[model samples]
Target: MKIIAYLDAGRIALGVVTSPTHFIAVADVAPDLPTDLIEILEREDGMDRLREATAGRTGDRLLADVTLKPFLHRPNAMWALALNFKSHIAETGLQTNPDFPHLFLRTEASYVGAGEPIFAPPYSVARAFDYEGELGVIIGKPGRDIPVERALEHVAGYTCLNEGSVREYQMHNRQFGLGKNFEASGSYGPWLMTPDEFGDPARHSVLTRINGVVRQRAPLDDMLIDVAHTVSYLSRGYRLRPGDLIAMGTPGALKPQPDDLEGQDLSRQFGPFPTPGLVHMRAGDVVEIEIDGLGVLRNSVITDPAFEGDL
Candidate 1:
């Protein structure tokens, strides 16, 4: 079943997307069910209940009529993988670390809903504001030290994610906190699809586009570390809880640099020097990230009004 979170008469509610343009509000079908998407998923028989509630019922309203919200407004944790794709590693000129996957955390505030505007900080036009399209895995059942083979069983569904980045801030330190956590810098979804409908996550394809031009495209299987391994690795330290989100890594550069400058010297040129092929977002550009079965996540780029020029 496909589930969507949206603003119904200015109030947040969950619904089941019956078609491309129609969805039935869960409350209308099952008033007793929780209104929040995360809470519903936390229930033991949440999926079954949703299916039963919307059974034989057509959508109540047109999708365009309601304002869509992020699938999970307050997911417990938002973990992102870095350098999982070999092509991405090559473009960034980073060496492969066979030992483990590089992981980072993004706060809830950093994400906006599909159709929402992606914030471009004051210097965004001058600095690097890049986009990374990735498939997001949502956890339903909580688990710790989960086995790789059994990891898929813990998954509830999947969605699309735009892992937007402020390249300049990211280079300030080894940590990606400030760069990735900029308010409204990234986006989550239009809705969520259950595992049964989505099928094998690896069989899908990811495509990212700026305006009308395609910038990034790659198969889900290109990742050096697959979804199962990522879940198992993360579960080793922390308990994977319901409503947790995992952003599978993105592929090679959507826009790559012309020159192949390696070593520490290249790193120093980030802020002062111009990065070839890295087109930082402007005030009116639209960015779209689409996954095979999952719907397209679209967002327009807008400069942060509060940003008063560069510091």
Candidate 2:
């Protein structure tokens, strides 16, 4: 089952996506239920309750008629993996970290919903802005020290995430906090697909396109650390609660390297370089991330208007 969070009559509400463009508001069937998607998922019988609430009801609202919101507005924690895909590491020419998964945190303010604009901060206009298309995992159950074998049981569903980045700030320090947490620089949503319908997350594929041209594509299984490992690793010292989100790392374009640069000053050419074939996003560009079965997450790029500095 697919669940969508959207605005209806000026208030946030939950809907069961009956079709690509149609849904039935859960409130229409269960008026007393909370509108927040996180609250709904926290309930022990959330899925069963949702199914029972919308059972036999024809979708009464058009998806196009309402404004969609991020499936989870404010998750308990938003964690992202860096260099999880072998192809991505190879593209960047970085040594693989074999000991553990590289993780980062993102604030809720950094992400906008699908169909919303991803603002290119004035500082990123030159050559820093970048995009990383990834699969988003939504945690359904709270757990601590979760075993890898039972990790899948804690998953509620999945969604698409565009891990927007600012390369300059990222390279300025060892920590990626400033570069990744820019306001409205990334996005998530459109809807959530339950685990039953999503099947094996690693069996899927992810594709990223900018202005309608493909930039990154790879199968989900390419990750060095898969979803189960990620869940287990993250839960060791931390308690993961329902509504926590994990962004599986993105795949990078494996463009052929130039032979001329083989032995010449490798240090200058290797780190945090602009991804081949992908340039900084300019105003009016549309970026789309498509994951097989999860649906497409599309957003337009716009220059931030609040900045006072010259671009």
Candidate 3:
């Protein structure tokens, strides 16, 4: 099952996406249910209730006509994996502790919804606005110290995540605080596909594109740390409640498309990159992330005009 939150003539409406272009308002299926996706997931039988109600249903609303909103604009807590994919670790020459997963928090403002523009820090601020496309795991059950064996049971669904990074601020320190949390720098959701629908994470791959050129692509099986372990590891410190989001880390950059620069020329065009062939996102470029069979989250890049010093 696929679910979404969108603007319906200025009001927020929860929906179940029936196809790439259509969705059924949850209000139509069950009027008493909460419009918030997080709120719905918080209920023990929320998904089951909605699932039964919308069974054999088809979407009545056109997806293109509605403005999309972040499915969980304010999740209880949002965590992301860093260097979980060994391929990514090799590309940046970064290391992670062998015993534990490298983790970080992202604020609500750091993400926009699908079809919205992801902000790039102004040129004067930073230019390494890179994209990390990863699988987004949405917690269904609240638990602490969740065992790795039972971790999959706690998941409600999955979504695509573009964990945008401002590399300049990221390298300023090791905390991964500022650079990783820039306002509106990332996005998730075209829609949320439930566990049964999404199937195995390892069977799929994440493919990221800047404009029309593929920049990152790799099979999900390549991750050094998998989803079950990531959830279990995070639960050790805090109880993961329903609506907590976890980005499962992105894979390494692929060979650049023929139209893009190569070698020193690539560096000259996008400034120095820690890894060659890294293409920093620029204003007016459309970024799209696709997790096979899960659907695509697409956003255009725009430099924020806020906090400018008279341009």
| Candidate that scores best on lDDT | 3
Can you give the lDDT of residue 127 in candidate 3?
72
Looking at model 3, report the run of 10 residues with the lowest lDDT sum: 263-272
**lDDT against true structure, model 2:** 0.83
| Every candidate's CA RMSD | 4.1, 4.1, 1.7
lDDT: the better of candidates 1 and 3: 3
Question: TM-scores for all candidates?
Answer: 0.91, 0.91, 0.95
In model 1, pairs of residues that clash are: none
Local error of candidate 3 at residue 201 (angstroms): 0.5
Clashing pairs for predicted structure model 2, backbone only: none
Name the candidate that leads on TM-score. Answer: 3
Error of 1 at 237 (Å): 0.7
**Candidate 2 lDDT over residue span 1-311, tens digit each:** 88888887777789998887789988888887778878887898877788889877789899889888787867889999999998888777877576677899998988988898998877434356788999999999889999999999999999999999877778878888688888888998878889999999989999988777777889999999988988999899799988999999988863433542322333433236644554556668899999999899999998876774657
Comparing 1 and 3 on TM-score, the stronger one? 3
Q: Write the per-residue lDDT of candidate 3 for residues 1-311, one digit (tens) a residue.
A: 99988898787788998877788889987999988888888888899999988889888889988888888857788899899888888876777986787888999999999999998888778877889999999999999999999999999999999999988788888798898999999999988899999998999999998877787889999988888998899889999988999998988888655656642255444333556556778789999999999999999988886845522
Candidate 2 vs candidate 3: which has greater TM-score? 3
